[model samples]
Every structure is written in C-alpha cells, then in structure tokens.
Target: MGVTAVLGECARIFTHPRMIFKLAQRELNVDISTDAYIDENRNIEQTIRADERFYLELLVIQAADEEPSTHKIEMYFITYCRKLSHNREASTGPDWRDDRQWIPGINMDNGYFQMHEYQAPAWAQHLNHIPSHIVKLTTLNTPIHRWSLPGVPDRFQVFIKRDDLSGAELSGSKVRILQFLFAEALRQNARHVVTGGCLQSNHCRSVALTCRQFGLTPHIVVARVSKKEELEAKGNALLYRLAGSHLYLSPTCSYESFSQRLRSLAGYISDKYREPCYCIPLGGSSPPGMFAFITLFQELIEQGLFDNFDDIVVSIATGCTAAGIAVGNYLTGSKLRIHAVSIALSKEELTKRIDLMLSDIGLSLGTNDIMDIIDGYIGQGYETITNVSANTGILLDPYYTGKGTQGLLEELKKNPTTFQGKKILFIHTGGKFGLFNGEMDQVMNLPGNHANYINEWPEKDIPLVQ
Candidate 1:
C-alpha cells in the first residue's frame, strides 16, 4: 500500500473537526476517501497472501509524542478493533498494543480529549489485567544546527537534531527509552533496574539518571574494554558513576559469552536482592525503546523540523536507535528517505535485527520494506576508530554522534545524486566523552614546542656590538 492511501485513511478515521470540515467541504465520502487507510492494510494483506505460513494479528500502533488525550484515542482505536474481531488472534493481543492501552491519561482542565473507549471492538477479550503508567517527557522545538566537513557537497547540509540537550543530566537519545523503561519498572514493582552496555554507554547513563529520578536503584553490567588504550574516565562512564550506579564488569568474552554472563548477572541480582529487578538489554533496543523515537518523530513534525528536508540521516549502532527513528518516520506518513549509517552490522544483518525487534513488539516492518539507505562507511569495527573517524572525532565524539556524522558525510559524497540538492538532517545520538583522551594528538599531529623547527631570526645583537 502506498503512503498516501494510509494517510487518507488516517485522516478519515481520526476524524478531527478540521478533517471533518474538509471532508464535508470536499463532498468526499469516508468510504471513498478511506483508500489511504488501506495502504498499510494492503501491505499487511499482501504479505499474508504471499506467505501462507504467516498469520495476521492485531494492528500494532506505535505511540509517539501523542498527548494523554490523543493516546486515549489510540487506545480506543485498538480496543475497538479487538472488540470487533471474531478470532482471538485478530483482537488486540499482548505486546505494545496492549501495553499502550493502560497508559494513564493526564488531566486537562479544558477537557480537550477524554480517555473513554466508547464502543469497543468486536474482538475485545477480557484477559489478565495489565497496569500501566504514562511517562512524561519534555519535547522541545529547538532550531536545527548544521555542520559539515571541508569539501563536502554544498547541497548536503549536515544538521543535528539536538535530542542531547533535552535535559542536563538525562539528555540524549537514552532519555526516550528510559521513560518507558522506568514506567515498566514501576509497573512491575521493581526496586532495582539492571541493564547491559559498553563502558561508556549513553543508555546506561540515562537509565541511571532515570532510576534516581523515580527513586529506583540502577545496576549496570558493563562489558570489558578489549582495548586498554581506549579506556577513559570521562564521558558516559563518568556520568554512570556520578549517578551512583552499581557497576558490574565482565571479562573478555565472545558475543554469546557476554550475553550468558549478563543473563547470569541478572538472575543473581534478582535472587539476591529479593526484590523485582528489571533487566534492559544493551542499547535499550526493544519495542518500548523504539517508541521513544516514534514520539521523537512526532515531536519533530509538530515542531516542523521536516519542513526544510526531504532526507533524514541517523547513525545506526545496535540498530535500535535507527530502527526507532525509521519506524517513527513510517508512522507519521513522512515520505522522507531515511539513511542509516551502520556502525557495526552489515545492511542485511541490521535489517534482520530491526525486523525482529519490530515483530517482537507486534509491529511488522520488513528491513527491505523500510526506507533506509545503508552505505559502506564504517571505517573500522564497532567502537574501533579510523583516521577519518579520528579527524571527525577531533571535532565530534567517535562513539555515537561523531562516527555517525563521519559516515553520513562519506555516504553523502558517494551518493551525490540524492544529496546534491536535498537538505539532510542527521540525528546526533550523543556520545561526546568518547573523544576526550589524546584525540587531538592523534588527529592534529601537533609537534612539541621548540623541537621540530629552528627559529628563523638574525643575530642583530652581535652586529650592533661590532
């Protein structure tokens, strides 16, 4: 299904006063104008038709910066769909769809929108009740800032959407994931939150800050730094310690071994503490985490950030951040092409991971189906820096934002056609402290004073004496 069809359907079903007025004035019937709704429906149906093994389930609605009132409408929409369906699978089932239903609504004195599911869907089923709490995040309309490397394309203006400045300590992309994580933690009655990541993980730092804010203890399991030379006391590591996070370090191990260790640690923490402990995977790369980006995209649209650009570029690390941003763009009916610069995984592997994450959340998005443009710009392996990366890191961090920008610049150079006359916005998923130690020395190659060159001065004092 095409995006336009889905948008048209959204306009019809959402049925705002303005939308209703437009429809009335245009004399367009809802039945005729509802083709937009079928775009996603057709896409889903086509997949189901093509694959007999796959079954259709509930419609997954990823909530973005939707207000409490607006969210209620979303909840009602899902609930109605469930109540109207005959098959249990057809109804809104467990996962994010169900999770969003219980999200509490904020009280508006004006009574703008109510949290009432007036007419339930036919597929509604009374199952185990789930308690939910709404998380509040401050979304801002900050002006876009653009930076670029020398000799880059004139049309390709690299702009950073500063989610890093969302708050002082709890800033960056991690805050979005923490909102849902903390809410879930409270819902499960967890006293401590456990998560895994690298030594200088932004997600870990943000999680720690969130735990502090909500009066919950945060325990972080950090992977051992393979390169001793890269270890430093600044950036995310410093923030994590400052936030009073319980740190657990794992020795050198393979990827599977690392996972096993993290699992064992989580189990131990849960058993020893005798209190519910929530474990958040590395990068907070879950459906809930993806919702943060969805909300971010919504906020971006509300702030009119997409007005000047036809393309959006983001750096892909665990693929979760990029996935979230991609999904958000999809949901908002934005046709803007999304370019993801993979920092670690190949395009195929990254797509698989993203698709699995989406499916786990009961939302289906094919990696190939997603509008992501991947380019070969990851100079070295994950967390490994190159000369170009180092140069970029001299001005930006290598961990998240800097590497991402560097990749974006490289991709822009390679794909001149798309970037030639189009404005590109790069989402800087903050990791600045990763570039602190001796980065300048490596990038600039500065020489010691009075050591490299002899002073070019004449012996004027001797001539005056003669």
Candidate 2:
C-alpha cells in the first residue's frame, strides 16, 4: 500500500507487450496486470471498471504509432493475489483455455485467462437486493458468459444470460416472472393461482411449482390446438403431474381463445372455493410479470454490461420479457437499443405486443424508442428452427432463443455496413426440457466441417422420465 510500491508497479505494468507477456507468463498467477491489447487503427484505448475491488485494474497504454500485437496475455494474477492476501488457501490455477477443465467447482469453464472463474471479493456487495414487495423465490442473479460460435462474424461478440440455471426443477426464464406474479398475488391477498398455457408451456409449469412453494394451490388450464395433444401429458405436462397441480386441458388455438376460456374457469374456481384468486394472463405477460425482466435489465446495469453492448438481442414468443427490457431501458433512462428477435410473431405483431405490455405497465414508449423487431427466423412454426446444436454445448430451442440467434446473424449480414463494428448481447430464454419433446434431426444433420463440435447429442443432460 506504500507509494513506492505503487510507483514501481505502475512503471512495470504500462510497458511493451514483450515485457507484459514475459512478466505474466513468468509468474503468471501473481501479477496484477495482463492482456496488453493494442489497437491496429487507433492509439488511445481504455478498459474501465466501475467497482475497483471486484474487477482487475485495467490500464491501457497509448502508443504514438499504429501497431497490433498478438501477445495480449491474460492477467488472472490479480485474482490469485487477492485470494492469497485474504488467506483463502490459494494455489496456482490451471490453464484457462482448456475446455475440458472447469474453473474449480461451478460446473462451467473459466474463460479468457480464468477471468470468468474469479468471484467478486468480500468487499464487493451483492448486486441484486430483494425488494420489500417480493419474497424469495429461486436464487436470483444468473451468470453471463461470452459465447463464440463458428461461422459467426469475427467482429461481433455474443454473450448469453444463463436464465436456465435459475432453479433445479423449475429452471427457465419463467421462474423470474413467477417471482413477481406470486409477490403481487400475496400483496393482493389472493388464495389461489389461475393461469393457462399450451400443454408444453414453461410458464404454466413454473406457476404451478411456485404456487405450491408459497403455500398457495395452483389451478392450471392448459389448451392445445388439437385433441390429440390435449389428451397427452408431455414435456411440461410431466412437471405439472409431478407437482400435483389441478390441470384442465382445453382445446384452443390462440392466447385470445385461451384467455377467454380461462376467464370463465377462473370465475368458477373463485366461486367454488369462496376465496379470492389471482389470475395470470397467458405466458404471464401482464404488467406485474414484466417486473422480473425490468429487474433483469437492472441486474445487467449493476454488473456493468450495458456500457459494452451496442445491440441487445432476445427471442420473443409471448414478447413479455423482450417488452420488459425494451421499456426497462427507457425506465432506467438508458438509450441502449433492443432487438426483439421474433420466433413466432411478425415484426408488426411483436411491436404491438411490446406496445401492449408497455401500456400494461403504464409506460408510454414512443414510436422512436430503442426497440426494433427483426423478423423471418421462424422456419416452419414456433416448434422448429433451422440451426442445429451438434455438440456446440449450447442448446437454443426453436420456440425462442434459436430463432432469435438466427435472426441476429441474418440481420448482421443484411446490414453489414451498420453492424460492422457493433457488438451483440444475446439473452438466452431457457427451453432445455423442450428439446426432449422432438428428435434432434435438425441438429444432427450437419453438413459442414466444424471443429470443437461434440458430434453426438448428450441424452444424459435431460434424462428420460417415465
């Protein structure tokens, strides 16, 4: 902490790549500085971190000439040094580039010089504090990872928000929505929950599970397009049975029809029980449900993700979360542009949904707000997309994430001049269980030569249940 030591460290760090790489490689785990990135077209570049204790101190050196260096070594030494200083039983970390070895215990790889593996120091405060109105549901705050895929343009960077890891049994983006809806139900002094969706609806499954968790009984009215699907308890239906929920499968086509059918059903439930009930609209896209996604955007800001992203992309089925985030940026006074990649709806339809949700929350998003809908990703229907995950270790379901990602790539290609220097942040809405509903024919029919591909789909990730 002395002036002399600080002066010596500064003189040592802001130097040439040979020195930085040599020093980093020599000790590797003890140095505070690493990754000497030099811009090819510019001389002035800086990496800024808001919270000093939580982030590795980044200082970029400006050169008089334009020269790109390939030797930008990663500095995980600061992380190791902090561990040793705190007397936390420190040891040398293994190579971060090894995909096989994980960052110790978190069941995920520590990417980019083990930067991903490091945790916030003890001095760092938790970003998300539960609100007075909301009770504890599943654990909040999922990890975000930098995702690099083959065939993607090198200039664009992609990151995924891991909403799938939000819970064990009810792991999906639906959990966040349930957290807010359940809290609102409690505030309204409701006794039971009434919600409706398709047979394989993640939203209904989450509602049923969360209702039981908080001592409220759940009544689910499930609707399918056909009589055959109505009779079957498949995918999300299995979870409903396991949760012991009261389910009624009604034959219907659209959310409008389902909502119409659910209204009479919800009325009957209240009359039968002689108690108040909270009724959630289809896909939990109401005003209260969108609160979780606003919290999601708030989480991104706390973690300093908003500064680096030029475009934020998310898949939309019901368009609730996408609408929440788009309007959330406006609520947070952020000018960040949101691209709602449509899996089912058209750009006009998605825009209407966004407009409707914004109205539900009583916020008016002008026509020129930071919201754009990029359509044409839905191949056949909501149940199918063209992109396959043949050992990519990431699964993007056709209903949402896959379609959004495909649209993002296409958008970049169509408007190359605009997105040439842009960075993308892809919000992954989880549908891992839905992957088991159909065959992996679209994923397995790989025609190109790609590396680091797992080749075969791991059936073990989602075990079959009788």
Best by TM-score: 2
lDDT for each residue of candidate 1 in 338-407, tens digit (9 for 90 to 100): 7788766678778777888777655666866665656576663223334334334323456666567667
lDDT of each: 0.57, 0.58
- Most accurate candidate by lDDT: 2
lDDT tens readout by residue for model 2, 68-155: 1212211333343344334311112221122222223344422211111112222221222222244455665788887764356766
Q: At residue 105, give the lDDT of candidate 1.
A: 58
Error of model 1, residue 415, in angstroms: 1.7
Looking at model 2, the pairs that clash are 35-73, 391-454
Q: What's the TM-score of every candidate structure?
A: 0.62, 0.63
The predictions' CA RMSDs to the true structure, in order, are: 17.0, 19.3
After superposition, the stretches of candidate 1 with alpha carbons farther than 4 Å from their true spots are 1-132, 137-139, 146-149, 225-232, 254-257, 373-375, 380-395, 418-421, 437-441, 444-466
Worst 10-residue lDDT window, candidate 1: 43-52
